[model samples]
Target: MPQTPLLSVVVAVYNGELFLAKFFACLEAQAIEGMEVIMVNDGSTDGSMAIIDAWRDRFPGMLVIEQENQGVSVARNTGLAVATGQYLSFPDIDDDFKPGMYRRLLDLALASNLDVVTCNGNYVYENNRKPSRPIFPEDKLQSTGVMSGPAWLKKALDSRKFLHVTWLNLYRHDFIREHGFKFEPGLRHQDIPWTTEVLLAAQRVQYTNERFYDYYIHSASVSHKPDTDDTLIRSARHYIKILEMLEAINQRYPEQVKNIPACNWQIAKEGLGILHTFNNMKDPQKKKMIVKEFFDRGIWRLIWKNARGFRLRWRLGRRYLKLKKATRVPG
Candidate 1:
């Protein structure tokens, strides 16, 4: 019989002192046997590193690797390099897992012999728990959707239903390593490409309608912070690059062309959504500047494409143009 799994759970952290204890406690409570919890402290200045150090002594199998201030992707990649698990999972230090999350997810992943095994997660903030919002076209679970890597990705992308989330799944170690894949070191939205890439290689897949992850809405998360940073622009560039790469992949897998529409539509809408959320920005100058800076060649084309289909989009395009005019950026 195979030796018990040394499942490596990598928790990526950077100044996550506020939630470190709860996160580790959640790890401790996981009923999965023979697991190693690898914590990556990505140059946290806060008490986060100290907290992890304390736990290093407390948790017998815990390993801590310290690095300079790098992004979450680098930290995760570092963990991946040293991980000895038969299976791999990524967890954010600010998130928690339901009881037996590892056990249930691992069982499904191994049983299916899949490159990837995904599960649904519940969104929890404060005291509220809600179903994980689907990132795919339709929110329906195929009563355990399973597919070949290409087939599954094509369907999900066409349906606009792929969640593109990193934490909601488990992956085979060899598959990840053999593919020469790692989280993008500095890209803010690294998961989009990483998940899409791996699903392209998945031979078999599995899912359970279980909400075993507690995805917390915390301000400390880089994604939740103010968007007026290099991180946003950098991540946007990364996203665009991924799209270009996928276009090349589509040449090889002609059936996945439908993913193009879903990607472009969401990119256009979500770009606008980001601006909408910034209605709370207090400084008009900053807001105007941000709006002006956010637009690019592709975004302008997306706005134009979407505008033709919806009057609301046309109005937005007009507003966007006026902002660009006011900001006096060359068209």
Candidate 2:
């Protein structure tokens, strides 16, 4: 058995052969000391397993867990169960981490004794070097500072850029372990709820302006394609659950949580988008089932309850009209 590592980077691999080499190259170049890579293979049927095997040969200490096609959430939880590190982070297989990112983040976290250390990331599009908007808005976090959990939560809720992502932060393993922070299994929108809960539980959170991670945006990603029935329904259901989570957090820490209405409005817009996707589907059976599901679960009622903004209300009204037309059975 090898000595313990300072940080454990958990990766969920599923048919990621195309980008495995690049990701491994970046990982091999990290200057961090005593770091271990814990990768969970979610039953990748492609050459992903082969690539992982090659890397395992090269790095004898790398921990790899194999499981049937459960989901990314289960893969991550599987990793968390056995990770033997002081700190933890989860990076996607397709993204790039700038050299020394782990080292820098670790330095910050250790120096400040923070529960979490977060940095900025660049959203790299295939055709463009720069995104239209910055991932971390200039005004959101003015400088390197330490903030209370409540302060961070309020700011994160106000600005879309404030909460960069789960992967952009370094979390103490003990902090997560104490709170029992596990990603919601079988849900694609696991990051939002899990991150929100972690921040709520954290006492001190540190932020830095260094852009150390690259988030590659592709057309094939789930967030970019919600047209299909399964994707649309899953995303909509997750959004409702996320809203409920935020509401619960707000109630638990009423004085700390601000802009609940704004957060609700943003999530409600996505809910409307899901309904629109269902409305545009051509398959009548799946469409009818989804429509029935939406009504049966009172999704529309929850959406209407939170549609406060004028633009959101307008969009919700339009989507509801289309849903009504789509749900009407021919006599």
Candidate 3:
């Protein structure tokens, strides 16, 4: 039997031919032994498979899964099911990371027996039009210490800059499996709730100041695309689900009192985001439908109940009044 690899990198590829070569090149540069790369090709019509095939020989532990195009959430969940490593990472195919990134994270995880280890990264814009920006400020991570996951989450949320992206961190396989944490299939922004749950459940989490990952921002990215009526509706629904998930988590772990306010804040943010999306929608009929749906689902009450701080509550109230008057929807 083969020894278990130290880490597993699960990437969901869908029409990512353009970036596969460079992504593979970055992985090769890592030079980390006993690292398994699981590539789930979600029915890519492009030459993505060809590029993956060309690089198959580079990693002895590489595994490839081919499946129908079922969206990224399903693709990632598929890869997560079969991963056989002590640690796990989910990275985008179109992104690259600095050399020695995983090695350092793995070493830290091993040394401290951490449930989750996260590091900083840069947001690299396409065409170099905008300069890269560090995901976290150096001052925020200067302590470089291990703390409870909820504690770390509280600090991060207080900073108001915590990102929910999965790729910035490495998680213990057992911790993930023990919780049966799987990305919701067909749900956009699944990372928000997933990350929140993981952090809340993690007993030992650490952060490093090392800027390792490069999250490339380009016009072609799914997030950058202009929101259509369908996409907006989906996004609104997704945020509503996130708010509900946070409430459930808060109730499930009542001892995590310090974490509850932050969680509620997250709920408020998502609620406001939904309201903003609804307000910006171009179609009046669609807007009316979304407003009615939000009220019917009691999302406004969720925001009002969970929203922290006087200013935030005031903003929510003001926005609700404006939206209610504009749409003539019930208070």
TM-score of each: 0.77, 0.86, 0.96
In the range 1-331, model 3's lDDT, one tens digit per residue, is 9898889999999999889999999988888788989999999999999999999999886899999999999999999999999999998888889899999999999999999999999989999999999888776654459899889888888788889889989999999999999997887788888888898899999998889999999987988999898789888888888888777878877788454588888889888889889877877777777777888888889889988899999888889776776567434
Q: Give the TM-score of candidate 2.
A: 0.86
Q: Residue by residue across 1-331, what tens digits does model 2's lDDT show?
A: 8777888989999999989999998888885667788999999999998898888865658898889999899999999999988889999988889999999888888888889988887778867755534568777755458887656766766665555267898899998998888988887777877776687778989877788888888765657754676666566667767666655655675554443455565457657666766766777766767777777777787778767878878878877776777678553
Sort by TM-score, top down from the best:
3, 2, 1
Which 10 consecutive residues of model 3 have the lowest summed lDDT? 322-331
lDDT of each: 0.69, 0.77, 0.88
Candidate 1 to truth, TM: 0.77
Candidate 1 weakest ten by summed lDDT:
129-138
Error of 1 at 157 (Å): 4.3
For candidate 1, list the clashing residue pairs, or say none.
136-160, 136-161, 136-162, 137-159, 137-160, 137-161
For candidate 1, the lDDT comes to 0.69
lDDT over C-alpha atoms for residue 183 of model 2 = 86
